[model samples]
Target: MADWQGVSEFVAVAETASFTKAAQRLGTSTAHVSRQVSLLEDRLDTRLLFRTTRRVSLTDEGDTYFQHCRLLLDGLREAESALTQLKESPRGQIKLTAPVTYGEQMIMPIILDFMIQYPDVEIDVDLTNNQLDLIDSGCDFAIRLGRLANSSLVCKRLATRKLIVCGSPTYLATNGTPHTLSELGQHNCLRGQHDYWRFREDGRERNIRISGSLRCNSGIALLDAAKQGSGLIQLPDYYLQTALDEGSVVRVLNNYQDLEEGIWALFPHRRLQPLRVKMLVAFLTDALTNKVL
Candidate 1:
């Protein structure tokens, strides 16, 4: 009989090159991971790792063993996922990431609802504006907005969002509305993380470098500033929707508004996604497409 006792521990250590990180990934103590890897090496009668105070590295034999072990472990996970699908219930921990504001405003509600629907499922969500490397973070997927850089990850467009440039009526009255693309240079354009605003000119996408007194990363703060007649603002439709409807702000430069950009779900390349991930993606697609967001 093949004893599979420390294979996972050894693989984790090899992949992370740190017993501490492996232990963190496995939800165990560093001592336990070290002991398991030591036992694994004893059972195989081979040294698989070179450990120094600064770093850990795999031996040539360990590298060969890891290639096979990684594939085997992947197969094992797929088998378990397949079996779970047979039960007709998605159950497992799903780790994902999304933009902070949008995740809080839109994704979090849907996620909470999903949790209610599937009590067996677990979720760990990281909300940030920065694009995290899904593989390094061990996240199953990411929710990304606007233009995506070319990458090997699989992308599914869940929805589309229009960028609206608008300001409070008072601001428009005081500073004058920008009727042409060039006129935008004359007004105070509230800035976000980027110094540029996107538009469509002559049926082509254009980015205009904008400057303003306030430069903030928070959409809500910029929205408030616009409502208070601080300056013109460009933001996603969701952020400006309520204000636009309530007469707190009005759209300007409509002729130059950019076409809607995609809200995408990005996942690492894999032959088969776990059922839970598929379900969550489906749920998000439905919600966003139905204009629930």
Candidate 2:
């Protein structure tokens, strides 16, 4: 019969890649750690590690076992954490990533509400237009403003947003409103949406290739341009709403509007999601759905 303690030592050694380090982590002597691993190998009838004076490396079976064992242990820890958190409000630093524009114009309000409710939880929000590595950067969750292209990361839809072209009344008087996408080619159409403009024609969604003297990845900048009459810009509804309602920017091409884009919260796929991430996601969804943001 295989001793679970011995198996645990093998797993620790595989994780550390050093028996001495594994022993330190396991709070045991080096000899005991080595003996446990050796006994586990004997019981399993296979060598789990290739030991050397310099260091250690896992064998083929050991490599596969290590992955499974790590998942099992980590999943167990997360499961227990979930139970513990059910009785208490989630409290901890919730690391989040979001695009610069959406974070400021849309998510920030929701975040403020979340902070008010979970006073014990601290938020670390990274507002960048770049795609951040959630695992490498230690982000608990990310607010992605567009349709998620990566299948590897798990995503949940929070809300849907539409893009519309708008321009200040002053700019319209000078350059004129575009009746069609073809007309936009003749005017300064400030672009961003990954440098591609969303359009719809004949009941089919399309991307319009556009350019202008001013281009930016940030929606806030795009809105500012339209406000300044620098150019007609396409922007998400949330950013344009205040401008649109106040008549600062007038929406054009209302009939031929593109399909609504999704706002999603994404996390790295895992057997068990951390409590902080789940709370944040729920808070954001609730806050937005309730028209708080």
Candidate 3:
């Protein structure tokens, strides 16, 4: 009650300098305003005002007390203002992670555009194949190609990416095109197919364990191998789209191609999400959906 009534009395009397005027301003009677001010003075155990027939003057202690009251009210107003600004405009650092290959091939261009548009946000981009712990690692968001494995984190799918079983023109011309998946064993293969090659086998699904001359964990390396005619490699559309379009590589098994892999932006639940995280997720979503990259 002191915190509440004291503030009103101080503002009223200070602004009007007359209890009657202050009471009128506060929509209360003059006697009630005088009693509230007396209660405030008693709480502080100090005489705050001296009244004459014509005027009321603040005591020395009252002058100091009023200054502090002004400061407290100003601080509260400033805090509220800052919070309102934060809700309307975003600014801060955001931690983001993504697979190296997909980040470079797809997410990078979008990130570049997002940065340009939102100069206030600083992005900490970590590109790796390993699934990082969002809570422990302090990452705000993650961009994944294919399906996400973490159930705790929520994901929004951006776009479908087609996986292509392709080889360089030189390799196909040299080793000859295999009309059937069975003939794939006959030619040298550079694998990125993620251990299991998805093909329409026996009118159902087939996950074939595959091997290659140069087995690498890096998508770029496998793409390089396929480009140099090292072997036939399987890659998603993001990495091989330009190569396929330029005739650097030719798609094999068009009928056997499977469409399942998708690009996704993942984040934890909303309650604990920071301002920066929300801004980045929105930034990435628009950038990816609109293909601003």
Candidate 4:
């Protein structure tokens, strides 16, 4: 029989595409992982990977082997998880990812509350705008906003937030509010991250390309600029709620509000997910549903 230890090393390397990263994930030395992979390749009598100074890539045979091995590993993990489920108390670390702003303002608090309830469970959160592959990054799940593209991951809805177009009263007074989507071309639109703004017109979604002297990726910076009467800005309700309530900003084009975007927890489609991941998703869903926004 092939050594299961060697198979695991090969799987890790294949998934991460870096021996150093695989070793770090497995909590082993680079040399140890390399040796195991070498031994496995020798036993199989085929080169599993093409190693270079920069990265490791799988050979055709290796790719086929990895697909089967990953399924086997997943099955093993699921079997173990099934047994752990019987214990009824979830334990272990859950690695998760989320966008910087929302993660900080919304998800982090719920995660902290979950930790309080399950003292034995630990969480590692990666806050970034980049979308990471859950299996490649070894993350249990990710919190995503807006419409998701086609992916193999399973998604669970947590909440929905409306998209709003707004600007400071001064900005609207000076530049005039856009009454229709076509009028947007006549005004300066402060952009955040993307140059296109989403809107709904006549039961269809439309993306309008916007231009201005000032552009930023930070939502807070854009909001600040909008509040200072720089230009009209489009953002989600969560970001503008306080400003709208305090009369610092006013929502315009209410009729053009984009479809409400959903907040979702996305995870790998596995037959048996760990109890900690399941519980966290359930907890966040409940907590977010109770939130007014």
Which candidate ranks first by lDDT, i.e. highest? 1
- Candidate 1 has an lDDT of 0.89
Per-model TM against the reference: 0.75, 0.75, 0.64, 0.80
- The residue pairs found clashing in candidate 4 are none
For model 3, residues 1-293, the per-residue Cα lDDT tens digits are 44666667765676456887777766889899889898888888898888777887788888788767766766765677557556655667788899887788667887777778777878889998888866445677778777657585778776667777889999989999988888877877776536667777667867766777877777778888898999988777667767777888898988887756667877753224556565566666666656421
Q: What is the C-alpha lDDT of each candidate?
A: 0.89, 0.80, 0.74, 0.89
Q: List where candidate 3 sits over 4 angstroms from the true fold.
A: 1-88, 193-195, 201-203, 270-279, 289-293
Residue-level lDDT for 68 in candidate 2: 81
lDDT of 4 at 182: 90
How many Å off is the CA of 41 in candidate 1? 9.0
Model 4, 202-274: lDDT tens digits are 9999998989878888888989999999989888888887899999999899998887889998987643468
Q: Give the Å error, residue 122, model 2.
A: 2.3
lDDT of 1 by residue, 48-119 (tens): 999999999999999998889888888988998788789878888999999999999889999999999999
Please state every model's RMSD to the true fold in angstroms. 4.2, 4.9, 17.9, 3.4
For model 4, how big is the CA root-mean-square deviation?
3.4
| Residue pairs of candidate 1 with colliding backbone atoms | none
